[model samples]
Target: MAHTIDISVVPPPLKSDWNPPAPSGNSVSPLVERRLLPAGPAYLAHVKRAVHKLTFEEHDKHVEAENERLGLNGTGANGEDDLGVGDEEEPEDLLTLDAKEWKKQDHYAVLGLSHLRYKATDDQIKIAHRKKVLKHHPDKKAGIAGDSNDDGFFKCIQKAMEVLTNPERRRQFDSVDPHYEDLESEVPTEKQIKNTKDPQFFFKNFAPVFEREARFSRKQPVPMLGAYDASKQEVEGFYDFWYNFDSWRSFEYLDKEINEGSDNRDDKRYTEKKNKSERARRKKEDTARLRGIVDLALAADPRIKRIKQEEKEAREAKKKGKTGAANGLSAKQKEEEEKKKAKEEAKRKEEEDTIARAEAKKAKAAAANAAKKARRAARATEDGTPA
Candidate 1:
């Protein structure tokens, strides 16, 4: 007997909101939920989807917080305004500088390192250059009123950077630094030193002069011009050092400008030749000037006079001692005299022996020459040649 199915009475339809019964206790973890999902590009796409979108208000708040943290709106963590580095006002004349006359421009000033000058380090130069570029770049002044397309000052800054960044070029520029030249000129002349009545004139004036000049010396730890009461050796050593001073300072900075755009090798050669000659002339003049300074210092030095007087006194004392010894001879003195006489006699004998040897050598040489001549004559006679 087959069971009759109740097809007419179907089970009530399940509710639309019906879900599976909750498992054991807590909710599924994100890791477990991801693992349970189907693996493929669909999973990756779902993982990459944004979980939440920031409202406009939240984004503005975030930007404000970042700006405050970074000090972009001025007042940094250090309580100082972000005014930037190298904000010093440039001179009007400097701004009007011609790029073509870059050699005449103060490179340090152009880089805003005028105060530091040659003392500015490589890093300082780079910082200064960056600052100047930010301040004076043509693009920065593109639409400014009264600012023409003149990038002359900008070009000058570039030239200054080119010089200061290169060790050799920086040195060349430093060699003829105009401010230092002015300082050198201010050093008292020989005539001025001679005329000065102040007792501390030499130390007050010459000390600073030497200190300034010592910067150019190839050899460091330069001996200084010491105080007035310096010992004879000290004074002498100072003079000796200056007299032999090997200066690294050169005159290339003062070289005449070569004709630009000229392809003539002869013009270049001529310019180089003229520059070299000028350098040599200046070097010679500088040496002579240094020598003159030394001479003046020596002449004016009271220590030199004192040393001379002391030497003279020592000689006189020594002469007096000799005179006293000669006047009265003790037994020991007599013995010493005899020994001295013997020494003199020995020295005389040696001199006579040396002279005898020299004479014998000369005679031997003469005899050899005569023998050679005789042999030559004999040979000539044997060969019936002119004797």
Candidate 2:
């Protein structure tokens, strides 16, 4: 941390009539020390009350002095409401109830320049403020019979002036203009969701929303997957993209201004620091909102599971085909093996037929030879009596 030193010079105390006694050597108890403090009936908490009282006391004193200078306090001790000389009324209109609600009010509407808020120049804003003030100034009711309180309409015009004259405040307000952005009103409805159940229809209708919200991420675009035939990995990727979506949306344009009536650099810096913390808190809330959207889609959408089942069946069929190809014989190889076996069988059958023919011819020749030999022996036995 950088070391800070107080460079401010302390002025010497004035030599006034009141003089305080120095405390004796420090042997006193805290109770006595606390009681002996010259600040009468004071505590640490009393200091805060003193600050509040001092601030309001100075403001009231200034008002009293101003009214006296202007001779407008004729009824000062009478405990009556002022007749509109130096008094300003704060009406409890809905928009004027809180100072911060100034942001919500259409400043353009407040200034009666609704059609020219963006196109109007700084001179135009000044002129409009002046004209509105002249018409609504409480002093204008001097000749009127009754109370002419318009219920704080003029204060809103002043509020508009404070906002529109400053360039930074005006720019920030323009970014959130209801007429300009109107994002909240464009939220997806149940009817729209049902109508866009088809993938192409959903993309046509709803892609613009997610794109405008966060698809500007250089990493990846988290688009809608509105298909029942989407794969398992596609489903996983879709959820992953949404869950870690890096939205380009920012709270910068809506950030609180540090320049609101800030008199010094230190005060401005303190306001800036406080506004930055609030912006961080709002950004955290926006991120949580995006996360909730993703969670809701994940839980309610049925297309991812259906697509996952489809992808699984397709994978199984593809795997089965590959397995069949791996386990079965090739067509050409099987045909060649069949041809070789048929050739071997034909050759073996031809050889067996040739052997049978040879055996039969040899037996017939032997029988004929035996018959001839018997006839010769019988002819020889004709003389040798009966072969």
Per-residue lDDT of model 1, residues 63-179, tens digit only = 678667667543534665444334457768878998988888888888777777887877777777777887789988787899553489889989998988899988888878887
Model 2 TM-score, 2 decimals: 0.41
Which pairs in model 1 have colliding backbones?
A: none
- The runs of at least 3 residues in candidate 1 whose Cα sits more than 4 Å from the true structure, single-residue gaps closed, are 1-89, 148-150, 312-387
Q: Which candidate ranks first by TM-score, i.e. highest?
A: 1
lDDT, candidate 2, 1-387, per-residue tens: 999898988999878887889888988666643455546534643564576665656756756786675555424345442322222322345324343466667777666566565667776676566656776776776677864444366677788789888877776666456564555345455566666656555445444555445533546545565465566777788778878877544455566666657689888788788878877886688678667656655654566557667779999999999888866657667888999899999999989999999999999999999999998998987888655
What TM-score would each prediction reach against the true structure? 0.59, 0.41
